[model samples]
Target chain A: MKVRRSERLVDMTQYLLEHPHTLIPLPFFAKRYNSAKSSISEDLGIIKRTFSLRNRGILETIPGAAGGVRFIPEISETQARVIVNELCERLSEKNRLLPGGYVYLSDLLGEPELLRKVGQIIAAKYKDQKIDAVMTVATKGVPIAQAVSYQLNVPFVIVRRDSKITEGSTVSVNYVSGSSQRIEKMELSKRSLKKGSRVLVVDDFMKGGGTVNGMKGLIEEFEAELVGITVFAESNFSGCRVIDEYHSLLCVEEVDVQTKTISVIPGTYFNK
Target chain B: MKVRRSERLVDMTQYLLEHPHTLIPLPFFAKRYNSAKSSISEDLGIIKRTFSLRNRGILETIPGAAGGVRFIPEISETQARVIVNELCERLSEKNRLLPGGYVYLSDLLGEPELLRKVGQIIAAKYKDQKIDAVMTVATKGVPIAQAVSYQLNVPFVIVRRDSKITEGSTVSVNYVSGSSQRIEKMELSKRSLKKGSRVLVVDDFMKGGGTVNGMKGLIEEFEAELVGITVFAESNFSGCRVIDEYHSLLCVEEVDVQTKTISVIPGTYFNK
Candidate 1:
């Protein structure tokens, strides 16, 4: 496939991010891009060093039979700025978002490159904190929480709205979400934070901050302290009752789910 | 802190797996274990080479203020087997686990060390599948799914039971869970999966296998192919009809929630 220098860097970064379990043979990227293996190596060298110099990532190369390179999910502010700017530009087409006051984020969430950048940005903020764990309610929260937990080197715990037989016994809690609706929820027994454990809570979106606040309450019940709260995006329309130590990757101001017109500004967290 | 050799390996592995965002300063690990920095570096060197030799992971070292060694989550069958065996043995306590019709995996899922290993194993299986994303239904599936997604460096997609304002518009699905008395509800975004995308599905426990099959249907609806399926533990009691191409880390026979007794054998996939 035809590619640009920037696109190649993105593709290479994306590949390493997706294959954290195995190294990519150096020749592999060369063959994929129809470039000499040596040239590919040089390109990777630049990208790797650039990432390191930026304090945004670590490019690791494994030697011998099973050796290749892997990309650690670390992104610097410069990288984040480039990505968020591109995202804002792409989603700027307000007319395409459609009625129902929501812009479709599935495509972006599915992008490996975008996810890596977002994960790195969120993880950077809480790097030194004694975060015992990372928490998010189930489903959409899994991806964001996974990214953060991966960066933080901690197990991620999920809180559920209802109990499933799979979770075994659960600890339940009730809280009012950003929608101002009180909801009852339960966390898997093994998923509870230890007494006085420090946790960082993350999610995909914050419409009312209710879900995140509820998670905070549940963490408190386990004698854990909330170290930080982060979201992929926060709805500007919602009243922000979320804790002071919070971050967002994006902010949405005008969401016309019915009209399909959504205005999204880059999240303030990116500037940090 | 008192540390076991095996536990040291486990902890190092867990530490590396959890912190894919940055390198671990050699001095930091040295202080944590009250060992010499040189000794810590030596241990890390062994780990780095072992992972590289096995085609499982990469050890990246940073040279300065922004530098440290980081372990990207990846392990080969041999390494995975070692960790998995330890996990089964540690959790095999019959008294600690309940015996009934289900297996109590809460404790295992809750512990950071165990969770990290579980994530590594699952991510190892799909190391080269070129998965665009990882998906799991709400509640119990979040942790496992998050774990796998983190190592794979892919975005995690959570399927919710009910729609929330934060998610905007969603596409709903109906499926029968293996143990549930009635058909259950699940949902994802209409825009989550792109056409012809490859998805890896994971869950915490498998009893009836209804939810997984339901996810398969959703994948098909999105015109995406199900690349693989994995679970932490699968129950032998439920004559469940799980799709053919799935794997489980452990096999559980019975769990008594009240009596606190459980029977868990290693999963058949462990042999493979």
Candidate 2:
């Protein structure tokens, strides 16, 4: 059956959004819509124009027999700053303060809309880099890694503190805990990360960068390259972080355990 | 700026996909596109018809003064079966089988595209239910929960085996480990879940049903209702499952340790 242009546009939009960072040849869409190449090309032009006009994302068209269109989702700097500013307010809630200067982030991270936007911000920043996989420690960092991986259209690896039976053969690394100043172990499935792949590390929270450092070491053990590391929030309470090169979406400038006050600002990524 | 019908359809499709299970007032779209209601409705008509025809999902338009449109992401029965069947093949790979009847699943779960489809399958099963949140026990379950929550447009709560300080005040519960017959503890932040919430539980794997049973009990302690429980795969090696009523997308029929053969079949959901 012949497909209408409107129908073709909607279906094509959905497909591009679903398969981000993936190239789909013109013939593929033409056959799916049972339309001519010229018609499909026309539909793509409209989509490309609209996507750019709305700042939705980038739609790159590669010309020639082996060429196709690819979608690279992006969060504009203006939009990212807005999201980070809003997070600062949410982090300032008095009830989020914990006993030992820890700020509760589970509630904020649990919000789906917030997580989606946060994922967009992080993925947008690294969209141009050659990232093979997103990596994070088990438990808190899993969700963030999954979110970023979704946008990048890449697989994610979870480095666990405790090795489970289901992981099969594994690679383990021991590092100094940045917070406790004690030795800790982290491991990943041998089958999870490819040798010499580029990996981006992400986490929900960072303090003294112990966990991030641990992941950096584990990456080396896998023979993988550490492309970058970013966190949702980082605390300066420890004053001495083992890893100096990192990006954070939100920064905890101070947490006054004495008065139950927490001051948070935009993280190391943005200009203050 | 005046938005054309074509642009409106593309933007609307992207917005609805990102915000599934959400109601968007027609006027909201009209204002966003700076178009008339009649034009907006016509654009929606194109999207709705295309979505249903392509099996993308259901586009529900509620008419009246307080009415709007809602997008419910779904996977058709045939599509779900295909995914489950493909999973059977992946699970049956000889290398996935490990000592002690365990099957390595991290590689499969790490795939973003596969995880998105799995999330859609699980979300479609519980799309109509009043799911306040998607809950899963940490480490393996976090990605699954996040994926399902993304489709359902609901927040997800992580129940950790060991509580982290960032969780703040938490509610802890002890249950007998289904596989080892040993008692283990689980904890969720007190603020992570609201009382009287209708929650859906999901996980990466199930054996002996101990973890699911523990979560079931934990749900009751929170005064929340267990709307449903689903697992990516369930192993029958134990020959005894603590939870009787649960759904599995793939089942490990048998694993021959001596011969190094693994037999997997479509999970309990299919009639095979």
lDDT of each: 0.68, 0.89
lDDT of 2 at A184: 90
Model 1 chain B: which ten-residue window has the lowest total lDDT?
A: B2-11
Cα distance off (Å), candidate 2, residue B91: 0.6
For model 2, the chain A TM-score is 0.97
- Reference-based TM-score, model 2: 0.98
lDDT of 2 by residue, B91-178 (tens): 9999888888788898888889999999999999888899999999988888888889999999999998987877888888889888
Instruction: Highest DockQ: give the candidate number.
Output: 2
Per-residue lDDT over A1-272 for candidate 1, one digit per residue giving the tens place of the 0 to 100 score: 54434334444554554444245798788777777777777667866665565464667788776788866545567767777778766665664464445555655655445665677788777754567788887666766776666555566777777676645567777776556566555564644567888888898877777788788888878878888888887778546565555788778767665555667788868553
Can you list the residue pairs that collide in candidate 2? none
lDDT winner among the candidates? 2
Give per-residue CA lDDT, model 1, range B172-192, as digits (tens). Answer: 778877676478888887666
Candidate 2: residue A231 lDDT (0-100)? 96
For model 1, what TM-score is found for chain B? Answer: 0.70
TM-score of chain A of 1: 0.70
